[model samples]
Target: MFKMLNQMLNRTLQRVSLFLLSVILMACAGTQSPNQVTVTGGTIEGSLTPQLAVFKGIPFAAPPVGDLRWRPPQPVTPWQGVKQTTDYGNDCMQLPFPSDAAPLGKTPAEDCLYANVWAPKDADGTTPVLVWIYGGGFVNGGSSPEVYDGSKFAQQGVVFVSFNYRLGRFGFFAHPALTDEAQENGDMLGNYAYMDQIAALKWVHNNISSFGGDPDNVTIMGESAGGGSVLAMMQAEQARGLFDRAIIMSGGGRSLFGDRKVSEATQESLSGEQYGLNYAEKHGITGTDAEALAALRALDAETVVDGLNLAAMFNPAQTNKPTWAGGPMQDGELITQTISDALQQGNLADVDVMVGATSMDIGGNPFKDKDALFASFGEYAEQARKVYDPSGQAPFQVVGYAVGQDRTMQEPARYIAEQMTSHGQQAYYYRFGTVAQSSDNPGAPHASDIPFFFDTVAEKYGDALTQQDQAAASAIHQYIVSFAKTGKPVSDNAAQWQVFAPEQSNMLNMTRNGDMQHGTDPWKARLDVVKAAVESSN
Candidate 1:
């Protein structure tokens, strides 16, 4: 009987030990150093800093390499174990700029279909999400720059995301053979970069809730090419309902996908299918059939990029001719029509939009001679000269800069806002005029508003930042955060931002005074003449 009692006591002790061990494990898991979250494909383990939880290099799509080089982004295969997402992935392949000036990561490769996310550590899955698209004229750029760090946004209760897409020739190339093959497979072709973006959006929509983000409340924002991309995605049929709002900075409306009229009229132009055939022929990869595609794909990525002249790709004057190529084709599938055409036809996504440009976005005018520049306006030349070169003594460069700013950035942005507001959609407009504190700095130049918008002034300008700069950044950042959370950009400290209407063209002009105020349209007559000139040309 004593032996039996001792055996029972031993069994009881074992049960107690097992229960205590499970309790210890539960407590330890509650305080684990790194955080783990399961997404669509698999579970991801991310690092936790003092400020935010950062998950980098998470694959949203399979790598576009080898036979998949020019195809639409494919889904990532599911994985079994937890994946450690610690560092950034490779940036999209492109020619390198100076290291100090380069906005890309250390390595750039074709296998670069990854995204990064930043979220508050204590988030409970209801935070608003902001997905950023970087701009390198659609030929370069990635999500790896220091200025693009999302810690600030995360601290303000936002889940920030950035991703890498195919760039340059790899992103936008098209050919007849490829189109034929796509038709056989019941797939659309061209605009692979945009396709990659759509895939990323779908991924985010499916998996963002795991990162404490609300899939229903997403804001898509971009500058320059990225800004244009916002418009593109808004019009893309495949991207419907992916985002609820958009922020476009320095993005052109009519010229977003190249001169649509020109591309359509000029059979041997930069953006159509003929241009693709010409590109293949230029590289001695002849034939308009499957063999040509085999030859084109056989050539390595570097060889394809090496054969093209970088200068011609960037210079509008050069590309205006039939010899050079351009990015973002007007293929009927991905980009059915231009942004202007889409907006006019009421085919855009019905989402709230905030659009703006800096004071001096494109530098001085592109024309060399004053007479030639004004003469392009034909009957409106006299009025243009009076409005743009009012002094008649202002240097051609100064006049050109003013005209270029109006033509390229300011006018296009205002036109988009006008169109949106006219359609009974909420639209907001602003003019970013906050110049950095430096003797060399002119008025806010192209892309200057980026640091301010991202609240990375200190990271970009370091010791040169003034208190006023910091305040401006804070105000702008707060405005964006408010917009992301609520449809309207309402902040306690900021002036009440008015919705843009066709009758009253008021803008929230951001100046160095650390105060944002409403102002009337400054270049009404100039933009009117500019718009007339563009319409007449078309």
Candidate 2:
């Protein structure tokens, strides 16, 4: 009897121990620990915060280094075990700027082709996806900026994503040898940056579903150069059907690949191949095609970047001239034509679009001399002065500011919207004019709407955010969130945002007072004059 009793006691203890171990394992699984998800390359582990399951530094493509430099992005090799994705990847190589004094997380590098994702902790593969592209005139900018945090969007049920791409000389450099090699491979040349973007989108399409995102409903959005990239992607044949919606904030509507202006004249612009030759010659890299390419490839990455003079490349004084030799190229296969030509020909991606610019984009005046400003208009100088400097008493600085804004951003954005609407596609237009209350800001300058749209005013400005600022940010944020989810921008607190139509030309203007109103095109007359002058040029 004693032996039987001991056996029963041992069995009960064993069962109890097993139950406790199972409970412990279950508790650990439910706790705030690292989470795992499998992507194309392999399984990746990310950490969970209160709001989001964050995954960073996941390789979307192999590092574009060594022989891979200047070549199209290649597929990432699969890895063995779960890859830790707790940190942001290297930023694409760029010169440091004052605006970006504080680094996002990691250092910049040539091997920077990774992407990051932010999804709700409880995501179940049915959330909308938003992929952001940063803007730095195609010469600078990265996806690791702190202001671009995706937690807000993730908290609102969005799977937010961002990635790094090649930039500057590395991104757009075109050499005869490279072109020849591409021809040998029967591949497209130039515009490698756009190729990188497409690769990321392809990755998202294939893998986002694993993160509880709806791959079929992807929205591509960007600011400035990023916005321009969005426009370029809309016209890219390779990017078709990759995204269902697009938001182009502060993107211009001019031709990207060629020098064709939105004006009536059709002029030949510098070809990407020719530009590459010029860049190579300027760098004293003279020799046979193979020798020149070898010399370029042998140079240190920092040396190449430091040698570039972006100030001169993007000199606003050089109007109608190519800004930089290494921007989006007109490689026939990838970027066949400019956005202007594509839209007129009705060859753009048949997707819904939201396009707008800040009230004071390209903030400062481009022209210092009043005579030079009027001279640009040629025959329409008198009319231009009358419209731009209506009072004749206004300062030249103010006059120049208006002219720059009208020509560069406002008109181009409106033109894009008009074209999209005319083609029977849904188009929404907005003008973000809400000025921050913290500083004595000069109107809503370029990129001012970013924080507001992301609903990150507090994160960016800290204690400076006023009650009014918060309200405006919330309204704009919800509008964008609604657009990403439902294909239409709706805000519970703001007025109904009307669809853009050529006849109505209605725009949702976020006023400086934090009120949203349906307003007519305030700059129509000025833009008409600017448009006429541009068309008359050359």
The TM-scores, one per candidate, come to: 0.89, 0.88
Please state the error at residue 11 of candidate 2 in Å.
Answer: 12
**Candidate 1 to truth, TM:** 0.89
Question: How accurate locally is residue 137 in candidate 2, as Cα lDDT from 0 to 100?
Answer: 77
What are the lDDT figures for the candidates, one per model?
A: 0.81, 0.82
* lDDT by residue (tens digit), candidate 1, 1-538: 9999999999999999999998789656753344777777888888988878899999999989877878899889889877898889998887654432226654878889999999998777889999999887767688898888888889999899999888878887777788887888776677889999999999999999988899999999999888999899999989999999999998888766754321344443544556667777767987768888888888877776653333435444443224234677777777877788888888899999999998778634557699988988888899899888888899988887788788888889999998888777899999888876653555677777887888998888788888888888888998888898887887668888999876677889887555788767676778888888888887
> Judged by lDDT against the true structure, how good is candidate 1?
0.81
Please give the range of 10 consecutive residues that has the lowest summed lDDT in model 2. Answer: 260-269
State residue 525's C-alpha deviation in candidate 1, in Å: 3.2
- Residue pairs clashing in model 2 are 125-212
TM-score of 2: 0.88
User: What residue runs in model 2 are displaced by over 4 Å at the alpha carbon?
Assistant: 1-34, 100-104, 260-271, 278-284, 309-324, 363-372, 378-382, 535-538
Model 1 spans > 4 angstroms off = 1-34, 99-102, 259-271, 307-312, 315-324, 363-368, 512-514, 536-538
